[model samples]
Target: MRILIAEDDPSIAAGVSASLRQGGHAVDAVTDGAKADAALRDTPYDLLILDLGLPNLDGADVLQRLRKRGTGLPVLVITAREGLRERVRVLDLGADDYLVKPFALAEFEARVRALLRRYTSQGAPELTIGRLRLDLPGHRAWIDDKPLELTAREFGLLEALAARPDRVTSRAQLVEALCSWDEELTDNGLDIAIYRLRRKLADSGTQVRTIRGLGYLLEEVKEGKESEA
Candidate 1:
């Protein structure tokens, strides 16, 4: 999934972004609340990790504006403010979960998974597209019961394509799903990612097909056809 982190502290932001990337998520980060709010408005994200002590616009105001806009996006607030009233206020502002600073990475990740699972369709954590199986909480994908060796970006790519198996996933959609703002997706970079994914799934029952002008599609491999698109 794609996540946005709104934090001013570089250390904390880098650490959290690395952890989430290791778990197969595409993460973008902003150092101030204004940029955070702008990213939230422009990008499609599955979760938002917000810090309260933000410059320009505070995280609470960000949350307030978010809710006022009627966006139901799940938010997980991470902050140094440990007061009960602060927690209550943030929750009242529409944060799905809150984690105080000095939190265990394990616990933080668990909260992320829980929120994602809770909001997923029918609350189903596992996504099955033919022989390909995805465990969102576990951040793993398998084909024919065998785990597919995939990098974090590749996992994000697969998830994005699988999210719309019957329809074409546009290049912009894949870029949004797989690349953060810092890691821009050039045309060659996109082609390399797609080539790598196609190579890994070559022998699987499915294939990634290039759609010429549109983008790409994931479909079952037909009999008497080339495996790679």
Candidate 2:
């Protein structure tokens, strides 16, 4: 998943970003609400970790604007406010969930997982494509019950492809999925990752097909011949 963390505190932002990345998510961190809003507008993120007390535009206002746009992007607000009214106000303004400051990392991650599950896959943690099985939570992939040693980027690429098996996933979308603002993936980089991923999945009864000028597709391996599509 690609996530944007809008937080002013460097320590908290770094910690949360690290944890999420460790969980196989691409994350971008911003220190102010204006930058956060800009990033939100420019990028397509699976989730947003927003801090209510922001510099230029407050978190509540940000949430309100996002909702006003009818985006329906799942937003998890983080605030130091413990008042019930404040919580309700943000919820009313379209914050999907809230977490008070000084919270446990485990709990924070759990909340993130819950939100993602609810919004992305209806609580399902595994995605299967023929003999290929991707354990979303565990960040692992397997073929015929044997595990494939995939790098983080490789796993992310596989997940993106497997999300819509046999459908064309454009290079732009794949680059977005594998990169954050801090890390940029060039066309060559994406190609290398795809090549490595294909090699790993060669015998897994699945194939990553390049669609010439289009993009890539994950499909069931043909028995005797390759597919031109």
Provide the clashing-pair count of each candidate structure: 0, 0
Q: Write the per-residue lDDT of candidate 1 for residues 179-221, one digit (tens) a residue.
A: 7777888888888999999888877778888888999998887
lDDT of 2 by residue, 1-229 (tens): 8999999989999999999988879999998989988888888888999999999999888888888888988999998989999898889899999999999999999899888777764557777776888776457789988998998899999888877765899999898898877888988999889888888887777889888898989888768856332
Could you estimate the TM-score for every candidate? 0.90, 0.89
In candidate 1 the C-alpha lDDT for residue 107 amounts to: 93
Question: What's the C-alpha lDDT at position 154 in model 1?
Answer: 82
Top candidate by lDDT:
1
What are the RMSD figures for all models against the true structure?
Answer: 2.0, 2.4
The Cα error of candidate 2 at residue 135, in Å, is: 3.4
- Candidate 2, residue 102: how far the Cα is off, in Å: 0.6
Collision pairs in model 1: none
Superposed model 1: Cα runs more than 4 Å off:
222-228
